[model samples]
Target: MAQRMYIVDDDKSIRVMIKNIIEDNDLGVIIGQANDGEIAYKQISSIYPDIVLIDLLLPSLDGIEIIKKVKNEINHDMIFIMISEVSSDNMITEAYEAGIEFFISKPINVLEVVTVIKRAIESQNLRNVLNQLKNTYSIDSRKNVTAPITNSSRRNTMKIYSELGITGESGCNDLANIIEIIVNERKTNNHFNKYNMKEIYLELNKRFYSENSIKTIKAIEQRIRRTVIVALNNIANIGIEDFSNYKFEKYSSVLFDFSDIRLEMDYIRGKSKQRGKINIKTFIEGTINLLKD
Candidate 1:
């Protein structure tokens, strides 16, 4: 069966454009459309949809309110895509907290609409598959352990770093440990600054080598830099395969500078490009945020 979708926007033009895009891309079928929040809420409450493309501002009631109401009343798996013209961080954060799967900034470009919907669909499918696997495993497993599944901080760090494709590198474990140290500093020290980064790097050196010298520190730095480069290349390769891949979409600009990521991507995709630079501080800070959040 085709995936079900509903559009909730006051702009008739946007509704038409998004409808046409959905049809053109064969991105499921539009089950309903509403120009007001109350009607949309009523429609969704009567029958749940697989996806909802909703504007932030709507008639009768606001979009965020509709999300809260529908999510509270409707007991079904649904993907909510927020449509908006404004780029306020607070609005975006609120929508995320409200459980929106994606956002489409208004004056909606056709390509952006298609890409965002496609990625959302892919993620929804992946989630369904994982749920199925979980169910099957639950039924297949006979013995139940009394201990809870606890992931150590090290393990969590490794998992996050693996998203960047650096888990297999020689210094990945050390790098993960170093990031944990940075996160700790961020949590504990109000005076933590970039100047303290050298101390953190040296601490990493202490974990690997008995004698810490300029040469060894440089070697360790080089290894880490190379590993970070490898991670960037890996994400770029994933982007080259599918630009809308959630991993690439989420981390490409967050983990590294967007310009650098784009250059690496262009090069990977056979475009003539110059050597790209990585902002180590930016990458570290981004990783720290990713871990903390």
Candidate 2:
């Protein structure tokens, strides 16, 4: 589906650069733009974007607050990526707690941004797949089964989520929440399947845009593997001796190409020339010290 995205930043150049890449690469649709925190929050709540690219510091509100408040009030399973100069460990943790998918430090790298956004999208989809299985299976396990005794779409969805490594992401939880929202929407709207990616873009645009601003149509594209790297990095923290573990094989090989998880994996872990089956033990005792300052 053509994903929907919004950019909230003060710098016109940065906005222009992002617009060019998104449009050139054809990542998704841009519904609106906001210059600061307050404006962003207001616009986002009303528009309900799939992903939000926000700067850390803004005129009215800071980026952190934007994430905090949006997550708090709207309570949607939206993806929030922080692009800022802030490097405090506390701030990073806070963003995670507030439900941000990833943090990109300033002097925003276009290539990096592209990569991150793409991973986020794939991760988000996986999140949806995972949640649907939880609902269908959890219910069938307890309440249904004898109620209908029909097809097994839920099983298929769960397989996709596991195979996709959507279960491995911090944002996986948020994605579940989003899937719930989509499911509810589907119940009331009979035309849900009729709305393909392009239709999804239009729906987002109509919700976010009340006026016709040319700048609102700016394009945004992703590198196709940025967030996957972040996901792998997070998984690495879970544990890995070399790269032979199930997690390594899963992220590096199985789930690698969804959004091209390779970019994010390469970015998170140092580059490895060897591709096929890895040789390291998956359980390395607290090797994170080497990764520390």
Give the winner by TM-score.
2
- Residue range 1-293, candidate 2, lDDT tens digits: 45668898899787777777788888876756788788789878654667888887799888888888766555556788887777788877877787788777778687888898889889777865664343232223334352321233323333434544545433333223223333446668844434443343344334333333333322100111222333344444333445566656544543333233444344334464222221111111011111121
Residue pairs with clashing backbones, model 1: none
Residue 70's lDDT within candidate 1 is 64
Candidate 1 residues 1-293, lDDT tens each?
Answer: 34568999999999999999999989987767899999999877644566899999999988999998766544345789999996889988998888788999988899999999999888767765553333222121234333222246656766777687666444455566576666666669843556455786787666434556766666555546655766777787788889899999888888888788888777656674353567666777777777666
Candidate 2 Cα RMSD (Å):
17.1
Clashes of each: 0, 12
Task: List residue ranges in candidate 1 displaced over 4 A.
Answer: 137-293
* Candidate of highest lDDT: 1
All predictions: root-mean-square deviation over Cα?
20.6, 17.1
Q: RMSD of candidate 1 to the true fold?
A: 20.6
